[model samples]
Target chain A: MKQRLRPILWLLLREYLEHRRLWALAIGLGLAIIALDLALSLGGQAPAGGLHVMYHSTRALESVSGNRTGTHMIGSLAALGGYDLLLNTIAVLFALTLAVALFSYGLACLYDERRDRSLLFWKSLPISDAQCVAAKAITGLAVLPLVYAVTGLTTVWAAWAINIGLPMTAGPTPPMTAARLVGFSALVLGVLPVYAISLTPGLGWLMLCSAAVRRHPAIIALGMPLLCALLNVFGLPNPIWHWVAAPLVPAGVGHALQSIEAGQAPATALAWVYQPMSQPDPWGGVILGLAFLAAATYCRRRHAVLA
Target chain B: MSESDIVIRARGVSQRFAGRPALTEIDLAVPAHRVVGLIGPNGAGKTTLINRLLGLLVGPGTIRVLGLDPARERHALMQQICFIADVATLPRWLRVAEAIRLMVRLHPGFSAAVCETLLANTDIPRRAHIGQLSKGMVAQLHLVLVLAVDARLLVLDEPTLGLDLLNRRRFYDRLLEHGRSGQRTLLITTHDVAEIEPILTDVIFLDRGRKVLDSSMDALAERFVEVVVPPAVLTEARTLEPCAERCVRDGYALIFDRSRGRDLSAIERLATARNHPTLADLFVAFRTQSNA
Candidate 1:
């Protein structure tokens, strides 16, 4: 198994280097978000000093029940709170970029498989179709998410540092916000798996397109998912058909939006504007992955012959 | 050698494409350590047969490579065999070195040293992308990869279709060197039989999907002789034996059967001497038999 993986890894590494544009896109998006955050930070006014009252309101019993804590309690409260806006924005941008990167990667996986002739190289090896597809899926699930998360963290840290070092205090925000930064970083890491799962359906479509299209694969590469979406939308009126179409949609969109508006207190205005859908299970993503493997195998079995 | 010495055995093998038969009832036994050339004109099912042998197709046929049924266990069977078809395309973006590395890493039997040596002979740069190389270079690279693999059976279908004369000669030289070891078996299909005739031990002539003739080179030469008889003796030769007559500018040429030791003494007693036909002439004579 280890021996067989050496070639796959080598090929993938070479591919990554060749398509340096992808990594550049990731870093570019990261920089853009940081700039946007800096712009917002600079625009806001100095915050009203409401920490004493807010701390007292949330923790009335702390002073009476514990060792007479006053200024320290307020500081801890400020350190622990009011960073939901940053987290929510970062999450949305992270998920969006991650989804785009994954879809593009998926399309490129099969497109480049034919274009690069690596499909033949891999098939010619002792590896089976399942192993080949699995390697691709693992790269999709594991490698891609880590890249997005790391880039997102770097972007956030860069933005936070710029905001603080510029001494731009926005509407009573944390004077020393390092704790909040740590908290958001941890949260983004936790949701990385969910982002990976959200992209599996797109990956499956990409795999099918890879197998079906020999020439100008990009047409099917872009068209298939849109076609499926159009079919599901048209099928929505029929009760029987809606049930069939229900499972295809990923839950991450709704969860991410809900987490955005539902932060600290549910913002009714924002929630009503964008009614995010319900969360789907991780196992659903696995089934989509299996479908990708099956499609890859079919493509390999029938038309995978290359020079 | 025992019957087991036959590395590839096919019986009642037939293949079809879109309801039309390409090859029918092909029974061929490829023995160990010999170069067998399959010759035919266009659309003669040579590629189809090679595909079936390499376990690259599935139809109503039974093919066994190294005693393993290709239909049921293609991967296992192909582990000991390598195939290079002339028309097949490889990924173009990979560098020559990258492509070689991929092949070596995957197939356990592939020899990296041989691949490097073969590339060293050609103008293929290690870092040059495959898409940038010419068609002849592609053919050379594919041949390099196929030759690098240490397989028991090597199936090459028109392996040098795109090579220039020099590269073609170099390819043959490499093939000769490889076959000189006398351990590997090769099945080559090409239109240029004369180019391959010197190295080939056996030839199988296919016409419209049927095996017209399968014979050893020496035996085929000794058995089938194209004798030129004068106009008067032509009738006598035709009478003495059921010879197929092809009109020539100078005289009536008759392809007489010499395998059964048929007497051509009477014709020779009357007309000009015989001229032994080259293998290409024999192939042309057999391939055009129905039309003639």
Candidate 2:
């Protein structure tokens, strides 16, 4: 197993080296997002309904909970809802940064090789086309996200630090302890797999286009999914539309947002948000992803370079 | 020769692209311990044939390299097969050190020491991206890549396609310095045949998708004789059925196929000078005559 894994691991590293700049861009973009947020908050009037209300409301809840007042219950639920909104929404933005890296990597790896005719050099190695595809899949899907997640969480910490440094508001500001940061890390670890696994089928489709298409692969890569999404916009309501955005939006959040908009309580929304992760693993979706990757690998071998 | 000695065996190999034939009816057997040059003009299917042998391509006939099927068992074949396909095949974004590291991890036979030594002679820095290097440096790097591997077969297709004479010579010198070891077989194709000629033990001439000539260097020298026949003995040389004739200062330089058991004594006596044709001369003769 060690022998078998050595080449696979090396190929994965190759993928990372090939697309390392994209990871840097993702991290940079994540930091830039926080910087932009900092810029807006530092000079301008603080938004009342944003982080301030949540910080103060949380502190008020902790104080009133000593007396078990109805106000404490409402305030606690409100604070939990605010945390959910702030973290999950920012999480989506952070995930987008990683997803962009993942999408570009999947949509370009084989295509660039074939375009540059470097697939011949890669093929010269003892690695098989299947091994090559698997490494790209595992790297772009699994490993890149991990790296992107770290950078993203670091940017989050930076943003959190900035928020903590702000002058005291009129309301009591709840503090973020080390434990809260750890909790945020746990939240990232939990939702990331759901994102990666669900993202696979779309990524596989993108890679298949990379291998098979002759020109303008981006048109096909984004077009089919965009069409499905547009159909949903037109009230076609195809579940296929969901697959288009499946990898982009972390699972359960979309379902919970829809449920909450339909009058579900904010406190009960965690049930909807965690529902996807709490269920049995979506092995079938993963299998479908593998099937797409298998097709992409076939296309690569069939037309890797000119005869 | 024993079957084990034959490094490449192809029988009735043919390939076509979009119904246009790229290679046709090519039969070749290159034995171990020999440096075989696949010489051909542009569009003569040299790269196509090499691609088939490396299993980057599968055509309409049988091809076996190192006693393994190239298309079906390419992963296994690649362990023993090293190839420098062309100038553009190496990834441009790859840093020199990353390439070395990847090779060390991928190929068990890859020697970091050999790679370091090869790099030591060149100006290519460890952190330099391949695209950042000059064309000459790229060729040298390519040589470093293949030569560092301990493989039974080394195939080079236009390894030095568009380099100046100095770089080409440097590449060949480096290739010769590290490429040859024990019973390793080499199959190479290049328009720069003269540079590779001294190292080639056998030569295969390909033209218009067909195998035109397959002979060892010794046999080629013995088979194709070039003689300067004066006007007086030009008629006499015709009896030898020279394949091609070119004008010189005083006589016609006639290329003859003396392998056909003909009496060349008459021409040898009549001609002022007689010698074996160079690989380039022979190649030009074959190409021009076939076109004619």
Candidate 3:
């Protein structure tokens, strides 16, 4: 097993190195969004009166919700409603950026090698086609999201720090502690695995399209759903359309946003978001993902690179 | 030769694209430790055959390289087989050092020390991406990487395409120096047949998806003869049924298949001299005859 896995591990590592620039681009874009947010807030464009009202409301809620560590972090975030909005906006932007990157990366991962005629070189190696496709799938599904999550969390921490330096809006400031920061980091990090798990089938489908199509994989990837929807209009049930489209909007992001809107603690929200893992739906999705992955591997092996 | 001496064997192999056959019922065997040249014109299925041998494409037939089925056991087959399809096959985004590093990590047969020594003599820098290098440099880099692998069979399809004459010579010289150690086998395809003819121990002629000729260099020498016939006895030479005929400055040059038991003495009496045909002459003669 060690010998079998060594080349596959190397192939995955190669994928990471080859596409590392895209991850850097995602992180850089996230940082630029944060910088833009800071510029706007510091330039007096922020609504200070509304922020003060929200801060008072948050303090009242914190007093009634019991003085716990999670409540303290929530109260700190609520004290600066503008910072809270910026943090959420940054998170949303990072998520959107990651989705776009993965979409493009997954669709192009197999096609680009053929377009550049490098598929011949890659095929010359001893590694099997299945291993090659698996590496790309892992890169797009797991590694990219992990990098985006880390970058997004770092931006959140930076926003929190910046908010702390601003003048308070009348009440006593919440104490900033290392433990609270660690808790927040954990909360953000917790969503990544959930996101990766939920989005695997969708990413795997894109890779399959990339490997199977002769040209313009994006058109085919987008058109297939529309075609399925058209079939639905003609009275056919389109479970495939639902399966493909549902995961496009990541379940973890939706759960996180819903928890935030409900005013739940970050730890509680994270736990709720991950609760689906124990259920049958996500496991079914995993099996479907493995199936798509196997299909992609089969396509990679049989499809001629330059044909 | 024993069955163990065959590194590549294809029996009744056929491949079709959209109902048109690219290769048709082709049978071939490449013995170990011989430099075999796959010579053919455009669209003659040389690349298709090579791709089949490398397990790059799946088609109708059985192909085994190094005792492993290419289609079903390509991963195992690849461990002992190294190939360079062309100069443009290397990824353009990969840096020189990264390419080497990847090879070392992925290929257990790769020798970083040998690769480093080879690259040290070239102008390619460690930091330079493949796209940043010249065509010759890219070919050089590819050659360095491929030669560093201690594989048993090396297949090259137009490996020196677009290279200058000097670089092409150097490339082949290096290939012959390092790849022909009596433990390694080479199967190469190129349009420049004259340049490779000297080093080819065996030659296979492919045309229109058919294997027209498969012969060792010595067998080819004994089977085909090119005779310089005087115009006075051109009719007598024609009775011997030369495969091809062309007018030259001296007189008429006639290519004959001596393997058919044709009377070479008649041609010798009617001709100025008889000599062995070069691979180019044989290729043209066979192809022209087949086309006719």
Candidate 4:
């Protein structure tokens, strides 16, 4: 396995070289979230990345301090799950940003080489089309997420530390401990693979379109789903907006926020992150995603000739 | 030679685009350890056949390269074959060093040292993106990449199409040296028949999607003769059934295709001069005959 992975690892590095703009967008969104957090902390505002949990906790802390006080506000904040909320907020924001970036990368990855006629050069190498497609898929769905996770975690963790060290007046300032910080980091890092897996449907669909279309892959990637949704809206019976239900789940974050606001459950990163995915089993969508990838690979192998 | 000794063998290969035929019933074999040139005009399907040979396109025939089905075993076949396609096909954003590094990592047969040595003779920079280079430089870079690979077969498609004269000669010199290893077979397609004629051991002529001629250089030399017949014997040479005749500055230059043992001695005795036709002359004659 190690022997086989060495070449694939290099191929992924090649993919990384080609897709830095997507890298920047994912990491940059994480940074922007950090900036938002800092601004909230400095401007004496409330946390909004995950707003309700942290806000209510802040309000409760202020009220308690006003009525009677000890150094237990930090304990109360942790009890209210403010830290986990903060972490989950970054997760949702990172997932969303990565999704947008993946959309652009997946659609362009296979098409641009064909357009530029660089496919000839790439095809000259000993690598197969399957290897080529695998490299791109891994980069967009798996590797990019891994790299950006570093940036995402650093942004949130750094912001968390800064807010506490600088004494934020309103946001959650849970008492920091090395164990707690390590535990929080573990939750976010642990979800990386599953996070990448949940991304397959959109990324795989875009990739298939990118390989199959001779021009304007984005239109097919975006338009086909829109066409379905529009058709659903006009005349579909018994189901309203059914086409909009499980579409790569860009609405996932919205669902998470709504669920949390409704007090159904704590917004564990796993729960909300998997919210847009089909419950009891998201593997069905995953299989569909893999099928799209397989089709993309077939298109690449079949249509390597210069147009 | 046996089937294993053949580097490329295509039998009854045919391809069509939309309703128009691009290649028709083409049969050619390039044996191992020889340089073969596929010489034709721009629309003569040279690129189409090259594409088929490399598995870039699939059609209604069998093409065996290194004894492997090019389409089914492309991954394994690619390990043994390398091609220098048209200029600027390398992505513009790729740095020369990056290309070298990538080939080294991806191709087990690629030698970065050999590639770098080839580049050292040129003014191309390792740090410069391919897009930043001139057309000639890009062609040189492409050649360097292909030449550095230790493969069983090397295919070049108009590899020097836009190169300057000096660089063109330099690239061919390197290609010739690479072919001299005696282990690699070369199959090249180009419109510059005159330039590649000296290096080709075998030549195939294609016109209007059909194989007009295919022969080894030795056979071609023995079978075809060019004569600058004087006005006195022009009619006599015509009786020899010359394949193509064109008026020269002084009289008429005629090309004769003769069967071995039948002899071109008649034309030799009647014409003012006779010699083996150059590949370029043969290409033109064959194309003219096919057109007629």
TM-scores computed on chain B for all candidates: 0.88, 0.95, 0.96, 0.94
- Kindly report which residue pairs in candidate 2 clash with one another: none
Tell me the TM-score of each prediction against the true structure.
0.75, 0.86, 0.88, 0.83
Off by over 4 Å in 3: A33-80, A162-181, A230-236, A250-267, B269-274
Candidate 3, after superposition: displacement of residue A247 in Å? 2.7
Off by over 4 Å in 4: A1-6, A26-96, A164-184, A237-281, B231-233, B260-273
DockQ of each: 0.17, 0.68, 0.62, 0.59
Give a tens-digit lDDT track for model 2, residues B160-278.
88899999999999878777785678888999988999998999999989999999999988788899988888887887788888888978998888767888887888888888888
| Residue B13, model 4, lDDT | 91
Model 3 C-alpha lDDT per residue in residues A1-307, reported as the tens digit of each score:
6777678778877887677778788778767755754564465444441233233444566778766554465556656555445556566778788888898898988888877888889888888877788778778777888888888888767766655655532123343344555655666777777777788878888888888888999998889888889999999998665566675654555666566555566787687777767877776776787788888888777765463
Weakest lDDT window of 10 consecutive positions for candidate 4 chain B: B258-267
Interface RMSD of 3: 1.3
Enumerate residue pairs that collide in model 3: none
Ranking by TM-score: 3, 2, 4, 1
- Tens digits of per-residue lDDT for model 2 on A182-251? 5556555555666677777778888999988888799988788778788878888754445445545656
Q: Candidate 3 or 4, higher DockQ?
A: 3
TM-score of chain A of 2: 0.70
TM-score of chain A of 4: 0.68
Candidate 4: lDDT of B234?
87
Candidate 4's residue-wise lDDT over A192-267, tens digit each?
6666666777678889999999788888777877777777677755221222225444335555445444434333
